[model samples]
Target: MEHLILTRDLLNTSLHQSRQIDFEIHKTAANVTRINHAFPSLEAAIRNMACKCATFGIRNHVDRALPTVSAVFKVSQVVNELGKLVSTHSASDLNLYLSLVKRFRQALTLLTNTCKLAIPWVEDVKLFLLDGTTDLGVGVDHDHPYQSNVCKTLHLLEELQGTEERSLLDQGILGVAFNKLEDEFRRLLIHNSSPLQVPSYLFSSGDEESDASDPLPPPPLPFPIVQNLRAIAVCFACDNQLDQCMSIYIKVRSTIVKASLQGLDLGYLDISLSEFDSVQEIEGYIDEWGRHLEFIVKHLLELEYTLCHQVFGQLDVWTDCFSKIALQSGIQGFIKFGNTVTKGKKEAIKLFKLLDMFAALNNLRQDFNRIFGGTPCSEIQTQTRDLIKKVVNEACEIFQDLSAQVELQRLTDPPPDGSIPKLVSFVTEYTNELLDNDYRPVLNQVIKIYSSWYDNNKFTKRLVSLEVHNIVKSLERNLVTWAKRYEDTGLSYIFMMNTSCYFSKHLTGTNLGDLMGESWIKRHQNHVEYYATLYLRESWGKISALLDNNDGDVKKRIRGFNEAFDQVYRKQSGWVLCDRGLRWETCQLILQVIIPVYKRHIQNYLALVESEVSPNKYVKYSAESLESMVTCMFQPKLDKYENSTKYTNLMGKIKNVVAGRFSPTTAAA
Candidate 1:
């Protein structure tokens, strides 16, 4: 199946190359430049190039060539005047000329959107889209393995969603269709109990004993033809570039029909689900009073109090596992895994969907009852419940174990201690368990670390870039030394170390060693630490690969952060914490920091992109996901300067550690 799918992919690539679609676009755009005699200048000629509906890929080149066109046009005007040519055109003609030029200019731009939708911090997800079964008919007449209705089902599935199939590489013209496919795919792939992780692809091992006693199942239906889906060009300004990638997608998917007609027993492969995490301010909790008001008075409305109670009990038991784990919750992206969670009453909707699935399983159970009507969910279902319980218990144990390890490290490591480092763990235990039915983990612990200053020291020990690497090692050593000197420095020193280390090691680009040096989980902080980490990734293309669009994620996370920020850091943005007035003194220093940073980078991100090239938009917007970095760090201490004077010395140390006094050349000069 993988080989067959590769063939289809190769064929599609061949088609694109042979078709020369982009090349043809380029030709057509240039052709439009010479369309009318009214284009007296080269810029005028180029600008008028997009009068006809144009693909962005081709026209964007013209847009880039505009300055040359303008120069050419200016020369052309001089030449025309030399030949005694005068302005002889109407306003309508000028409009026509400008419109054409505008088209050409529009072509030159590439729309790159930084998806900033705050993909919430999910534990893990595994969307398994492929499944299969087989039957044996080993008579003399038996030709090949009998694949039941599986192939037929796959065909029906692909055919039923043709409109959606056609729109894979494209994200426009069928937002509904695309979303529908995504939702359905998620339903098929992810389960209510766990994330949507799947088994590793089966690989043949030479000299391995075959399972002849129980013959292996027939292979899955052919791999679904899919594009890597790099980029799409669209006009974000007027939304002219419709999400029409479906057309090209449909053309490419024609291979599916051919494969089906030929009865090829191909298989399928799903992209591993991507993982990302973001920090957001927690929203307000109504506390006991609000809970009683809603749940008690509304008790009759929610008659499933018994079930609710059970669920809460279950949740309590389940949540207890994370207590020692030092686990923290953050915003989760609902529709991030090529799966869209329909917004509104989201948790309720999720439970209802689970209920629907449970109902289906119940129907299956009923069929089982008909087959062995004497059976009960108790005795026979023991295995099922055991599996669930085993998995839950095992997971809790692992969480506890992992958390304990980190806690131990935190106790042992402090600033001024030996070479201890920062670490973080992103354990997708559910994904691993569900996907690794063969019990082989797919997502292992991926670790990276780097060096830095201003971490693990009593103060913010800034160092120059030149000595930053060595100083980073020094800082690590200091942390271990400090750890040796003290008991568990939980809330005070450890918190300060974690907080200081977060700013020093993670803020700019990453340095891996610092991230993974000592206590892997307890000390880890450098892995995409921003609340909007994903949003800052790609600075290109209008159509994100649905997996990592920062633009889509940032806004969502920003809103989340804002809600949390108002209550936490800036509730009294305009006022003092102890007093009842504006904290002007502290505000000034914060502005000193905020202004410089914002001026340096804020508008770096773009709002709109009109491109005729690859689909991914050229992201103009920068520093988006840093919204948390802004509110969390900036406003809380904005006017706390008087109270924060002690940290000023630390800040100076950090500045020196991060950016030194001078280089050799400067000192010598």
Candidate 2:
């Protein structure tokens, strides 16, 4: 507080530039002359003031008995000097007064380190104190004074060069400034105290006429503003250290750009028969994304499949709660926060390259696919598209942060490259967790989201792009092999005609026809009811015709098909007997009994039970059955594949297997 006042007064007069000097002494002398001559510099002024300070007989004392004016007038002077350095006017005269601050800093350090006082008013103690009393303050906090003196401000490390040659950033010049500041900070740190220190050779020669090297120095007083200066210095040091952060940041930006470009260029190629939610126009089935769509579609399709997975009953309760949290709370909050950020960053995003921008978004959507599934709908795509449209930001959501970290790892060093064993090791841990942990609710959530969003019932997202291409190629090759098997041959042709006459309606369709035999649909359709009675009446006759006493294999095969059909209609959704011309939904009136018996003709009797009319309701109740039925519904689909030749050939394989196993003719002989 005392020195601040002195600094305040001197700051006004330190504005006039006298001259520049090379060495520390010349610099100090010139500024000292300014003060003695009122030369608008603090060093000259401080030297003159020190002379006057000694003449007035002022001693440095905060207590005891010295008169205010004579005991220590220089205490007020030192306060003023400190004030001047921090003052606005002294700041305005920065270049002219910098040397003065240097010298002034030196003088204070000399006085404090030497611990010697030279003043006329008090000589009682050898210490620098006015009367060398031991009292500082009864109630003052030590850190208080240091805290009060701090002044904070920003200082630029690099000033721009003249505008003429600037096309891009001048990293050379900018880097140098950062390097210098870093070096200065390192040097200061060696002293182990970050406090601003003045070098100690600037004090004036005192009362005796002595050589410049051997002079009695003028009295020195330590300045009390070290704490504030230290804080400012740290800010400078931090700026210097972080200067190189941009270099790495720009590199990360380019990698993301490259990925987005690749994905976008190939994203929309069409090879699928199904409609695409994102694409508006198409020329044939050959679009931009091409065969890659199959893998994408496959992963998407997997979302729809309800498999016999090992469910986690142990984790049901927690998993349920977490699912609710994810859907109802955390994700909702993120949606709100994310929208705000996206809105704000729209302008900045415009500056990024379109391809790079597209690539980044597509990459992110890929991550979502990993969590959710592959056939993301228009709504989900819109959400994803919105996300993609946004500019890449420095601050990230936790998920985004995690995604970035994962991508960083993938791009920087692919894990599988060096650790196939690690992958195998990881898979075991993963499998164990899924089997043993309480992931039931989470598992359900995952399935639900994946089914609804990621899976398009066509393919999985994991198989997108290149994988899709391979799959399509493999599928085409299989079709060619199938075509070769249908060439006609021998009396087997007569049996094939008989089978086709009975089953041709089942096997036929686009891809479906390629899969099943003819009459696939007719075999299962009204056969449940239309042929139920007739088939039942003839069951024993048909059984006798097909199997003799030695035909154990035929009996077993028939038993298996019977068991599968019986089990489905027997329990959960009981089968009903319905009359002809009555739709399955009108079963309440036509069908008298809901569950039917498999007494005579098991397969035919079981097929005719009518129940669900609505596809949705049917799906809800008969999902498992629908999946099974579709497995066989391909009969019509396959029937389209019908050639008497292929049928005869397949029957030949079956006949060979039966002959190898049984040879009942030999037993009879």
C-alpha local distance difference test of each model? 0.26, 0.27
RMSD of each candidate relative to the true structure: 42.5, 29.8
Candidate 2 global Cα RMSD: 29.8
The list of candidate 2 runs beyond 4 A from truth reads: 1-52, 55-176, 179-237, 240-248, 259-264, 267-366, 369-382, 385-640, 644-669
Worst 10-residue stretch by lDDT in candidate 1? 118-127
- What does candidate 1's lDDT look like per residue over 317-429, in tens digits? 21221111111110011112112111111211122222222222333444333322223223334433333232223322332233233233333333232111323101111
lDDT of 2 by residue, 1-669 (tens): 323443453334222211111232254344434433331232233334344445333223212212322212343245235423422122223333334444444444343322223222123211222222334323223243311111000000001111111211222212222333333333222222211111122122222332446433221111222222233233333334332322221222222223223433332221221211211122211222212232222222121111101111122222222222223212222223233333322111111122222333344455456433323233344554454433233111211222222222221211111111111112122222222223222323333333454356433332222322332233233322322333322112211222222222323332233323245435534443443333223322233333222345433434543454345333313111111122232222212221122122233323433443532321122324433442331122112223322232222232222221112221111
Candidate 1: count the clashes. Answer: 111
- Distance from true location, Cα of 635 in model 1, Å: 34
Stretches of candidate 1 exceeding 4 Å from the true structure: 1-200, 204-380, 397-405, 410-499, 503-669
Position 630, candidate 2: lDDT: 24
TM-score of 1: 0.16
